[model samples]
Target: MKLRIAILGTRGIPNHYGGFEHISEYVSTGLVRRGHEVSVYNSHNHPYKDDNWNGVSIIHCYDPEYFLGPAGQFVYDLNCIRDARKRNFDVIIVMGYTSSSVWGSMYPKNSAIITNMDGLEWKRSKYSKPVQNFLKYAERLAVKYSQYYVSDSMVIKQYLARKYAVNSRYIPYGADTITPAEREQITPHEARKEDYFLLMARMEPENNIETILEGYNQSNSEKPFQVLGSTDNRFGKYIAHKFKNDSRIEFKGSIYDTAKVRALQNNSYLYFHGHSVGGTNPSLLEAMASEALIAAHNNPFNQAVLSKDAYYFSSPAEVKELVETVQRRDTEKLMVSNNVQKIKNLFSWESVVDGYEQYAMECYLDFNNGKIIS
Candidate 1:
């Protein structure tokens, strides 16, 4: 329909690094291909300005300290809303509800604003009291101000329904397409390191990383476990050193390269996801896409994703038991292969972008109908 759209929190898209980035890239590019005029508001640190990345316009905003992390998100996103105010976009999609969504919420009924609420920041135990309180307030503001909210997991939607009384539709993170030949060559069965277990995640306390290490250390199995992700934090490094004597565990540090991470995923004997917070994590989705025999923390969000296909653990004993049980289950491998096909078919880039594309069309029509966009 040649609709004009602008995206905030533009660090995502162009497949930069994280899950949201991959999603943004897919959806934004899909819109561009669908004949919509799209522009992503990016930071100055990004290498390009006003360039066509996958048919989408790239608008670079010059925010000096925006890259500093959580706090700076508000500053840059405020700039996005300010600049977008002068444009003719029919819809403005923002991410990280507290970051760009909050910026759009502050604006009047100028644009149809849709916010993607990826995680529950209020549940994290690491933030200070003041910050946590501020996050809770921001969550309210985001819901109150935006026209609609998109949640990636059912758990998150339920949390919002209970906590903020908002309804969030479940649109999970999409999975990449791995060709049969590629999958065959990359399988753990082909690799000599196939016997090793795998854990991939960003280093954080609430992720229950400490317990995962302790469980691995207690394991009587001779097979080594591969740990991927940065452990720059004091506690993360301390845990690493404590388990240093156990040659069964090896920390590979932060792997920014998706291809390398995928290879590891495709090569692992099994996958371990210990995230205790957030909903519909990208790393977990990617792990499933790689067809890893899985053992995840027993949480509603993880359960929703696995859907009775993978193993779940609540404690160290449970994790060890599930891992061993998965070792003997040939039927579980068949289910993973089947689920891999399902994930590819249902969560592909085409399907995901089509969903977002429909949402944009609806928002555009609502704006044209003189509806009050929150």
Candidate 2:
């Protein structure tokens, strides 16, 4: 059966940046290939020459850059969701509920709502109380209203079941950008042929870029660090200045070339993940795909994702010690890469999207069969 669906959130198909955008690109492409009708609503700022790509209808997000960050983007997304409803879509795949959930909740009738609740956005550390509360309102609205929510990690799934009383389906992250061939293509110099570790993130306070950089500084200073990230917020700038003083800490701001990051990851001795917030980060999964020994922050989300396998660091002392140990460990290296290889295969874009497409198709099939949905 052909399914009419619209994906809403963080720009649209032909993704420019951001994790969810890539997801929309890959998932919609997968759906299109599976003989389903798919349309992706993208941000107006998202650049793409044609509105249609290989049978997938790409809808412009309607003035994305016009919006000043989330406040502006939230309004843009609400319009997209409303437009999606007007199109009489079979299912609306909502990504980034923090922005679009409020509008999604108001859509009447039993539309199959499948939300990719990427993470607990409201609980992030940097946002103010009111801002956080507003996000919480939006988050819960999406959770309570959507027919189904895709929890990317068991940790978040458990949170949903216990806290929201909503039974979410667990669909972990997958890598769409990085491939084994891509990894092999990375040059040693680009991967910091010199002595260094790799860290890439959004330069957000909650991601703990500072903590990791500071921790690295305190550690053996012989090794340099390569941070492939873009700074859009105050915290990012602050950390950049603090670390700029150290020639050893090379902050290559906002690298759009993922291949470069992957190349770096391929040749690096380790990948430093300091994110204290969010669930199932795409960068983490991608880094894991490179199969480098990972030293991540000791959060249950990170721990659960890496499963009893990844190294942990909560402070400078811990980071220093663990980095030293991990760089030297023959077993740790093999274990992390092997585990990443194992999990990532199951979570590969092909597998994850197939699961999503099947689940989505099942929901639609059930709806048509009068077996599921109210």
Candidate 3:
């Protein structure tokens, strides 16, 4: 059934940010293609100032977060919710609840609420004890208010089930395998092809950026290691200071250009994924889709997705050992091939979109029948 859907959270479409924005772009457009009316909320300062994106309508709401700092996020969410309440939407999907859950009651009662419970945010090392406690409280409120929940990983689904005694639907993020033509568009390598390893993630503590850099430093490998993403934050500055003397480590600040990023991933001798807190990471999936030999952090979330196809590391020592041991580029050729096939069959955009569409339909039916799925 074609239902009126409104997607809240994230800084809006064309995905200049993280996973939620990425999913919002794909799912909103996909729903529109399926004949459903979809409206995505965009922050006033978003780069894409258009009234519409693809077939989805964009509602620009005032976001004071730029001037307000951390507290500004709550104001932005409140503004979005206030605007959303004015319009009647059949289903409202909120991506993350670090700020939005506080305004849960402001959502329209006529609509069904579905919250995508992202990885345990309270567990991140970046937040202080007080902020972590607030995050935990926010998570509880998000679960209590929403009619249904969506988990991006099986691990998160299980957490919701055990902690809140609520069943959540598991729906992972999607990725596309890079085409040879796309590689050609990015052009010949500025960095030597397959000579350097790659690590692309936000320079956050929970992302294990420092650990990865330390591990790379400990290893005697002569290959250059390219570190992508911004290094201007407090922790980033610390990492930069600590690894400043290591000439092998090259910090290439956030590469948002899709073609260039894909080329880096596709040609890297090895791709390092050190994210410890999140569910199925978009970067890891993107690296796999690029057929890059991966070495991810050892965790249930990463393990569930990569299984036995990817090498896993925990400490700086382990990462160092891995770097020293896995010398050849094509050593994990079989695993890389397996990862490529996994993306086509399981993590494709079509499958991910279908999963969301099916869940939305089910929630809509339940809401219409005066039944709450939660």
lDDT of 2 at 287: 77
Error of 1 at 8 (Å): 0.5
**Candidate 1 off by > 4 Å:** 66-70, 101-105, 180-190, 370-374
Clashes found in each candidate (C-alpha, N, C closer than 3 A)? 1, 4, 0
Between the candidate structures 1 and 3, which one is better when assessed by TM-score? 3
| Range of the 10 consecutive residues with the lowest summed lDDT in candidate 2 | 186-195
Cα deviation of 286 in candidate 2 (Å)?
0.4
How do all models score by TM-score? 0.91, 0.91, 0.96
Top lDDT hit: 3
Native-to-model Cα distance after best TM-score fit, residue 293 in candidate 1, in Å: 0.6
Q: For residues 1-374, write the lDDT of model 1, one tens digit per residue.
A: 77888878657346665666678877888888889988887777665554778788888776656456656767877877788888878888777665655564456466787778878887887787987888887777788778777888888888878988776656777888554554555434435456888898777777777777777677687777888888788767876888889887889888776666777777787788999788888888788888777778888888888878877777877766655555636787776786687687767778778778887777778767976434
Give the best candidate by TM-score: 3
lDDT of 3: 0.90
Model 1 has an lDDT value of 0.75
Q: Which tens-of-lDDT digit does each residue in 270-336 have in candidate 2?
A: 7788887777887888877776667889898888778766788888788778656555466776676
